[model samples]
Target: MNIQTTLKLCSVAALAVALSACVRVSTDSGDNAAAQADAAAETLQDAAAGAEPADAFLARLARHCGQAFEGRIIANEPRSPEPHAFEGKTLVMHVRGCDDPTRELRVPFHVGDNHSRTWILTRTDSGLRLKHDHRLEDGSDDPTTMYGGDTATAGTAQRQEFPVDQASIDTFNARDGLSVSVTNVWAMEIDPGQRFLYELSRPQDDLNPQGRLFQVEFDLTRPVDLPPTPWGY
Candidate 1:
């Protein structure tokens, strides 16, 4: 072969090698980018799985904001001798006062024409808090108002238990005939689109030999008309 021809062949060979290297580098970069994207997605999934249960519970309950549900007493064990106040009364729950639902939610519980009770759920630094807000028809706070407790454990998203806190125990002690409530343990459960439950229980003791068990279930499938604004809003 001629010298110029040989030189041209060598140039072509080097050019081909350089082009192949460029192609390989481009493919490797694309593969690396895809791997990083996959890793990022997996990290996000793991984070969601490890989220706090109390936070998940709050998020689930917030879905019912601005809605009302009808409820009935499902169980009242060791039944009262006389007709209980909840007997033959219409029960309704209005999920309202949700300016920032994740932070706080107020649920008004209406019985017949009475609008004196509200259940306040709040997300605190540690976990969730449940407070009973009782008021009179005149919009005045009841002597037994603001009595409830806080979640002591990392309950599930569907259920949470609130054992009577020291504050609530103090309130019960101050009130006459309310000493039996010192052992109260309140619980709430939700099955999204199905049912919601509010429960109260107390262990057997001298004051309450039979203890206490009361539960009310609300149907979430069918929301009722909004009830009147609760007393003391």
Candidate 2:
């Protein structure tokens, strides 16, 4: 009977030890599973953040969005006035479309109170491009206009602008009467004291029936004192 009792006690101890080992294994498995779930959730969140193409482009555009800048127009082809000048013209850019950005964002400009224009910029594999998306008063692409000209002749190292394509021309006109092209870009610079500057030349032949040559200097710096609205009211 003593031998039997000793054997029985040993058996009971073994079973208890085995049960504890199983419990430990189960707890470890639960912890690992929880950790894996958390990792997967984080991965999913990262994907969601990058899914929107517009958001990415908007983030890029916002970097240069809110700053006030003066626009200078250069006419490659001159028509009337010997040369047209936009030196004294005033314009404003209101960038409020970031709420829901797209691959392209259209922001409106108000000349104090005159509905000036809507500039649309799009993201492309090459770089950021102006949509040149415009509509005619009749909502059509004017058959007589060209969106942009070829920039390949400028220089290989200078990728400031791309060659204009025929496809882009009809797309903007048919969808909207407005389309624009960057003819030439020169002297792009920015100052740490909140100033940005660039020179742009546009072919006025597209807009006016008679060719026009024009260029204007841009003040990219923020406005300190915009003149009061034209004294009409």
Candidate 3:
């Protein structure tokens, strides 16, 4: 989805569901060289778990086993604001088990470039979280990733744990910056049949003298899916 570049370019903001901060994100020189190692170990673990064993990306897509749904990017800015490169996209989501109280893949997203990172999401009454199914080219433990989003500042996000909430599902949408006068997210859906929508909006007080803000929606669909995880682990 190229969102890795988008996320890398702009920081994620708290949806006001929680008082969060920035997540410090980093990577090592031996990127793909290590991915393969992690995959092998994970593959073996999957076989032991009795969960479906999937590789490449078909396996990941299998997890999403429900009807197609739409996703809209609601803007955190004025109504007539500029166009977001990744705005207005619908994703067919296969929320395997949102009915589960403790965990749910109600929402999932493609991490960086297509086939790179796969994220599973879970939501609770108080807040939400996620699991980062990370791996290297050779199935090895990847460099420990630390992500902390910004609560209300610049270049200051919480470390990528959530270590508190790390290893959970909502890591992909975690924030590392404050919601500015303009706030919004570039929403994308993995399901191929869904339609693109946008929930554009701006904060009440931040409105201009006209007592209004600029927000808009458009369509840009590129059907995509998650990469397979050998195990649900």
Candidate 4:
């Protein structure tokens, strides 16, 4: 072959090789990006599928951490023989103690000037647990403290019901005039940016045929000023 022809052929061959390399690199990069996207999608789907209802409920409640809400007694039924402490009282709930929100949340339930009650929600291996930590003015535990229960089922993200556990039942049995609370079923509901509900119910029984129901609803749309720290922390 002539030198000029050989040189021209060599140039053409180099150009073709360069074009091939560029096409291959572009295709490889696109394939890698697609693979990465698919992996991320799968990971999200898996996480969603594995998530439990209690997890979603906790997450929803955690959104209100560091805030406070005003509540009112919506229903106090059956009319207790004695006067109710919540009647004509200003109710406030402070959501705090959320350093490890995924595991625990402490919400102080203030009635008028009383800061003796706290609702503690904790995550468990099986589901979630709710405990009423009652304290005296001097930061001492009350005789009827820690009287709540764990969730019995996989409730919705907006609500969870806790049936009185054996420990609470025993506590009730040990106290006078508290036997009526042995069959209590407490439920908490949250509608983000709308409202929250705390409910207590008892089925009809021989001791009290009328049963019982008490519910307090909080307005989440307007966060109130942070209340005092709960007694006994």
User: Judged by lDDT, which candidate is best?
Assistant: 4
Distance from true location, Cα of 101 in model 2, Å: 6.0
Q: In candidate 2, where is summed lDDT lowest over 10 consecutive residues?
A: 150-159
TM-score of each: 0.79, 0.39, 0.27, 0.78
lDDT of 3 by residue, 1-233 (tens): 59797775555343322333212112333444244344455445555665421121222323334433334444434344675544543323323443552444433332222222334543333233334444454555334332221112110011111222322214323433322322322112221122223222233455334333332222213234433432222
With candidate 1 superimposed using the best TM-score fit, by how many Å does residue 215's alpha carbon deviate from the native?
Answer: 0.3
Model 4's alpha-carbon lDDT is 0.88
Per-residue lDDT tens digits for candidate 4, residues 1-233, read 99999999999999999999878767755645554454455446436777677887777778789999999988988988898989888999988878998899889999999999999999999899999999999999998999999998988777899999999999999999999899999999986666789999999998669998999999887788898888887
* Cα TM-score of candidate 1: 0.79
Cα RMSD, model 4: 14.2
- State, as a TM-score between 0 and 1, how close model 3 is to the true structure: 0.27
Clashing pairs in 1: none
lDDT of 3: 0.33
User: What global local distance difference test value does model 2 have?
Assistant: 0.43
- Put the candidates in TM-score order, highest first: 1, 4, 2, 3
Better of 1 and 3 by lDDT: 1
Give me the runs in candidate 2 sitting further than 4 Å from their true place. 1-61, 64-67, 71-87, 100-116, 135-159, 168-217, 224-233
Q: How many clashing pairs per prediction, in order?
A: 0, 18, 69, 0
Instruction: Report lDDT (CA) for all predictions.
Output: 0.87, 0.43, 0.33, 0.88
